[model samples]
Target: MSVYYFAGASIVAALCIMIVFKIHVDKLKHSPEQMGAILTKFFIGVAFCEVVPILLLVAGFATMQTGLEFNNLLLPLVCIFFSMIIAAVFIFLQTKVDVTQEMRGKVYTFAMIGLSLAISIPFFSLVGLLIQMQ
Candidate 1:
């Protein structure tokens, strides 16, 4: 149940990032420079809200697994960060095009693809425990 809640919240959080980008893209019509500034703010906001909590969760998981040392946690976290960066570029590129005929459709498609890993990777850790029960 908690995992479901976390997964739902992660999806919502990723949606929020897309929302922020959409809002900035709208602002681009009036002030082009604002897009860059706004995106920088968006990244900072995501770092505080999304990245930090995810890292803390990873740290907590290490504490729970007897053989898992906290010192080794950095590698996975680094991998996730890089993966997010690659995704962020597409998220950023989506903002480049002028507001389109299929804007909502595009937003939904981008959000689903970009956020799948964001939501799935954490929830995936629980899969082993679930599988073991059977």
Candidate 2:
């Protein structure tokens, strides 16, 4: 149960951080090229972002001898892979659309929301489950 608490807390924290960052990007009204730049920054941030929560998750599993193997991590990896595919399609579409920069910015925002939700699900679920067991 305690592990779940920490896991859920990590989820909420991650979401809050993403939302705040999204809002900041919304203010920028970035063009497609600029959107690419923002995404690059996001990739960098995500690496740093996963560190603590991941460590805690592994620690919880270790304590329980949960036998959660690398295979268990596949769900989230798949989610992210799919999300990236979708985003790539949207970006390609952006090149085709003669839309304003502002519209492209909005599209990028929505696309990222989808991407973030995809990336977060499994990690949060692992945490939630640990919390539930306790």
Candidate 3:
């Protein structure tokens, strides 16, 4: 029921993303041609950072049960632990993306991986939440 965990997750994610953006902006400052690609990646990174928190918040708000389901905290705790770790993973992927031929494939691969994770992790969290409430 604590909002602090969700808020902290968002803050940590935003801070990590801001660092990535700063790095990308400085690196591309000399070549404005590369800015478009970086901006695209930046937006993707932003989405990466936001997905789990929103999903978990929705789950928590919608899925709480009427009884003492306290023993099931472990499931959500694990889900939340891994959810927080995704921020660092996003930073890694964002920093790796570049506007180069060799790096193009890598970017797409990382993006797909990120997208897959963004989908799966929240889904698992929802399942965990539901299990806990039952």
Candidate 4:
């Protein structure tokens, strides 16, 4: 089914993003400052890619729904709130770590992967929803 295809594609996309992050982290080994800057920028880029499309989907949903129902707004609002919380927690954890250590590098990689998937999966699902709507 198309749903399976979408899910597989989403996973693949997440994996690719993780691999890129790992590569970047490896390359920026010497300068901690530059590493942090790149990491933050990468995180923001991923978050923007994942969030903006969903927000557009939400807007589309709002427009499509005739009645001004609270329920209609609830899902997107909740997603936005929880995403902010998750992002905050992720950022806090990342900043607390010293990525110079091998263990910490691994931890950071896993954390980045987790964050990427967390953002991507929902965005992809929302995209699927929007596609289905059309």
Candidate 5:
């Protein structure tokens, strides 16, 4: 229960943090080219962002700190994989949309929301790992 509780709470916290960051990005009013550029750079950024969380996961595993059965780790691991896939798809598609093809307000907004949520899911495994380590 502690593991699940930590995972769920961390997921919620991460999403909230992402939402805050998205709000700031939304205020920038970037042009379509700018948005596409950001999306391209963002792929690189996500990869870097994942490094620390992954190292934390490795540390936890090495220390045998996870309180759950081995199978229990599978769900969160799969979640992290799927979320990265989703983020990649969104970034790829968004970058492909030219200015003529782009929708102004809601489409970009929705995409950012989705991307942030996808990014946030990895925190589930992260929190689950960190809580056990402590």
Candidate 6:
């Protein structure tokens, strides 16, 4: 129950971070090519950050339901495979979107910040789970 709440909060936080990034991106004047690159990098960062954690969290929940009967390595393998597939799709779609310089720096910065928040929340949730198990 609490894990679900934590997951929800993490998702909301990620969305907020993305909105902030969008606002920042809107403030700068970027050429179409620059916008496309920035968006591509941002999407890739986000896709990796979002999918991996959520899949791992789902796998964790599934394992918990099974009462520890599952092989530990299976979760990671599944998560990695699915995350890669999802990321490839995201990159492909983002490349198709018709849409930076100092803008490059801002884009990378926002991407990093967004990725960090997105990745960290789930990581902290993992840590909390570990602590609870101890």
Q: What is the TM-score of each candidate against the true structure?
A: 0.38, 0.48, 0.39, 0.38, 0.40, 0.43
- Candidate 1's residue-wise lDDT over 51-126, tens digit each? 6446544544443433334344444434444445545665657655665544555444444544553444444434
Across 1-134, the per-residue lDDT of candidate 4 in tens digits comes to 33333333344344445554444545454454465576676667566545544454444544443334444444544554455355536543553545656446545654665465555654654455445432
- Measured by TM-score, how close is model 1 to the native structure? 0.38
* CA RMSD per model (angstroms): 10.1, 8.6, 10.4, 9.0, 8.3, 8.9
> Which candidate wins on lDDT?
3
Scanning candidate 1 in windows of ten residues, the lowest lDDT window is 125-134
Instruction: Find the candidate with the highest TM-score and give its number.
Output: 2
- Itemize residue pairs with steric clashes in candidate 1: none
Q: Across residues 17-106, which tens digit of lDDT does each residue of candidate 6 receive?
A: 455445435533345336656666656655554665566455445544222222433343343334334333433333233322434554
lDDT of 2 at 10: 51
User: How does candidate 2 score on lDDT?
Assistant: 0.49
Residues 9-28, candidate 2: write the lDDT tens digits: 35543553455455435533
For model 6 the TM-score comes to 0.43
TM-score of 5: 0.40
Q: Cα lDDT for residue 95, model 5?
A: 35
Clashes of 6: 1
Pull out the clashing pairs in model 3: none
Candidates 2 and 3 compared by TM-score, better number:
2
Please give the CA lDDT of all the candidate structures. Answer: 0.47, 0.49, 0.51, 0.49, 0.49, 0.45
Clash count in backbone of candidate 1: 0
Better of 2 and 4 by TM-score: 2
